[model samples]
Target: MKKSAAYWIWTICLAPLIFLAVVWQKLPGRVPMHYNINGEADRYGSKNELLVLIGILFAVNIGTYLLLSNIHRIDPKKKYTAENLPVMKRFAFIITFFMTALSCFIIHTTLHAGSGFNGKFVVALIGLMIAALGNYMYNIKPNYFAGFRLPWTLESEENWKYTHRLAGRIWFVGGLVLTVLAFFLSEKAGFNVLMIITAIIVVVPTVYSYRFYKQNLNK
Candidate 1:
């Protein structure tokens, strides 16, 4: 079953490259390769630039899938279980799906050139991805590769459990807000909110984990 899942995961990771190949001939000599905060195409480059970008994304996608798939083997703690395996694979597929969609979005943007990429749409996509991950974060077991994995959290299962629970809530709510802001705010404003919220989600958990560690020491 896991091998079948791996095959599907790799197929999804390769989808963007396949898509690019099909549309390669249709792309113009110069295409919009970069967009400004306002979502206007500001940099033009050869269609080969898109090819390079797709190649890089594909490499990253495959590398991430491999790492997640084998994370249990590499972890010294080896805290994974038969149940945890499916969850990890599902998360890997979610990430693969997001990257594939992102690559397709970029290709569509390049193909349409001046149609103007929707920055808000990308923002919302990221938000959705974060929210989806957060939804699973609570169930994540202690692995060296994923989650808060702080020194303090990894040392103590209690810290890992409580910190992840808190972080999961923070991320889910923050992600939802970011998604809503993408619809209502300017691109720049939406990005600003995303940065602030991302910091909050990361910092809050780190601080909480450390505090939990200190308090336990005092006890």
Candidate 2:
């Protein structure tokens, strides 16, 4: 039961949910549970539903942390090396932080109906997260549970490194562009554009990985 640094990080991330729970009775009875791309709350539910959402979020983050921390125990092919430990810890921190932000945003939007949470901002935050991940993707050692897990990449360490390096550049640039676009475009238009950019970000790397593998095979 010796907790790792990631456990501490997750605890910090969960703090806001605990705070919200303490103040739950004071919140409005009918709260906005879901919002559309236009920044309007299209769905409504009891404030108590927030508790369910928070519980699910907490479970997901903790479960992911445990699975990742003990990946070696589950996957025989993927053992955690000393060199990869820091990278894995950093990845866990990133996921926890992003979840924390999202949980807080949901709570805030519920508490303050006019809080102006919109798709553009959410997309921008996603962009920022993608960029951050891209920055570290190249540092990640080959693992079954993480990184660009295309068959080609997983099969060859060379393919994994090369694909990640290329993917890192694509995601960083794509993410930056998406973040900027989120500010200038209309909410609906921004969401459409975000989808396109995301598709490109995902598809390009996968195709490249396969091609790279094929090239190596031909050699």
For each candidate, give its TM-score against the true structure. 0.93, 0.89
User: Which candidate tops TM-score?
Assistant: 1
Candidate 1 residue lDDT tens string, 85-187: 6667667877888899999999888878768888888889888888888888888877777899899888888999999999989888888888988999998
Q: How many residue pairs clash in each candidate?
A: 0, 0
How high is the CA lDDT of each candidate model? 0.85, 0.79
RMSD of each: 1.6, 2.4
Per-residue lDDT for 1 in model 1? Answer: 79
TM-score of 2: 0.89
Deviating ranges (above 4 Å) for candidate 1: 81-83
State the lDDT of candidate 2 residue by residue for 1-219, as single tens digits.
Answer: 346764677576687688687678778888888777678888888876888888898788777766666665555455446556667666777777777777777777677787756677777888887887787888877777778888888789899988889888988888898899988999898889888988998899899999999889999
lDDT of 2: 0.79
Candidate 1: lDDT of 127?
88
- lDDT, candidate 1, equals 0.85
